[model samples]
Target chain A: MASNLPVPVAESGDIDLVLRQVLQDVLGLSSERVAELDAESGLFGHLPELDSMAVAGLLTEIEDRLDILIEDDEVDGEMLETFGGLITFLSDKRSDA
Target chain B: MPMAALAGNWPNPPHADEYAVSFDSGRAVRLLIVPALFDEANKLRHFTVEVMRALDRAGIDAMLPDLPGTNESCEELAGQSLPSWHAAMEAAARHFRATHLLTMRGGAICAPTGLPCLRYAPVSGVKLLRTLLRAQVVSDREAGRDTSREQLLENGREDGLALAGYSLSPEMVRQLEDAELAAQDLPDIAQSELGGPGLWLRAEPDHDAAQTVALARIVAERLA
Candidate 1:
């Protein structure tokens, strides 16, 4: 007998898209604005909208959408420091999952 | 359109009057809108009102009621639990003579039984509590206080706790940790159908007219 569960796919491009969506949805950023964000674009402390409180919502939304769990200890300044950093963190989390 | 309070008479002593917003044109179809819980409630309020307005224009009546311990309700938030909320919603359904239920997010967990429920992004209560706890942790960290999620859970289960500005009773916290979305046969309005990401996940309260129109159209067509 085979399980009917869908296999989880870990794709960098998909992780990038997910992070963009989390930023846009959590911070209410426009699609065009989020699209312009590059790998080096600064996040935490840089974007006025991504305040400390919004970080909680952002991580929760990411965990829900990506089907991953983020331990409290894993959240820090580095993971959210740049656009690419979050994508990398999520990609790694998914690969681990 | 009228703003009023629904009287709750349950668990013995009657609960305080909870504020409610309704669009009534004396329509035959009545919908009781159970709002998202806590922070999600604030983020989706504008969208919820827009849906009610659209429903009114479509010749349907809709009501958005405040759960006890929330919004303008005279009851204390720290004293309200999930069971109390369920009772209040059941009373609201009765008071409004609702023919259907439109529950959003965490609201699905406390929706009254015996109605045709239409859910929009219904979520588990455990996830809601976790999000609140996570927010509290983030806030504490910003203030240079090192608090963990497990610590918060322990505190919440012991003497209750405050998260995201709302104080919770120990019972409420415990109940919420175990609450699950109940109705499975109901239809869900997916985010894709709404034309954008869920408004409830946004950092602040906002509205999307296209999403409102899409949601109201679905309700109108389904309930018709």
Candidate 2:
């Protein structure tokens, strides 16, 4: 685990880019589709592609890339409601880790 | 013959396998009963069987299904994504109308889909990934193999093996490496409603007290 690496304080734009990339890669969605994602989008209810398996798959990807651990209990749908919320949460987690 | 009792020799049996268990309601649940992953599975056979027998006596129908890419269920490990595995669990739950689901070690996440879940010595997928990556690094270093994180990811490009149990598809690997589960807010979605009561049973003197507490609190709050 790359736990020792200093967490990067990414700008909002950086967060947006990373979040979009993650969504694209994990959910098998295209950038064109993900580009329309806003801060208030519903991941499961809105996106037909985001099933339970996709959720788990997305979590695994995020953990590996961000070098953070997501306990099972932390996996609720609220954190994924909006793109901004997800980014903010990641930013906080990076700083904490 | 009924598949409820262990048929072979105890502990160091000639072979280990999963069988279907039936409930009084006449429902059946598929069980993926194998030894624990790595040496734990091998060493804990007696304890595992004892627990299974106890659960059986309690009238909880259970089965240890064959793992993907192993045993009679020769499903390709590459195709065994988390969703697929969950679906299998859901099928098992449906078969048994299981009110409670239990998993050991790496198989804990497989229990959360439908039934109320009870995890014994559960390990998170993220933690498992980190440990696997770290172990790969250490093993490569010791074995004098030129294995870098980049190489690991690259090898993952073809067919990446998770340290926990099964191998992941390239797409699955990339998805896992890039996405973060903790960042995703789940309570908002009605789907979080599906997570029934979750209880994490830990060994006495758990080293990760903070983590265990956090996990239990999170599950409790969400499922409440």
Best-performing candidate as measured by DockQ = 1
lDDT string for model 1 (A2-93, tens) is 44343245477788888888888887888999899999999987887676567888898888788889998888778888998887787767
Instruction: Give the CAPRI rating of model 1.
Output: medium
Chain A TM-score (model 1): 0.85
Residue lDDT tens for model 2, B33-105: 3223322333234445544554444434445544443434435657655555555655555544555555555
**DockQ, model 1, C-alpha based:** 0.51
Could you give the interface RMSD of each candidate, to one decimal? Answer: 1.5, 14.8
Model 2: CA > 4 A from native: A1-97, B1-46, B157-166, B175-224
Q: Pick the candidate with the highest lDDT.
A: 1
- Let me know the TM-score candidate 1 reaches against the reference structure: 0.90
- Runs in model 1 deviating more than 4 A are A1-10, B1-13
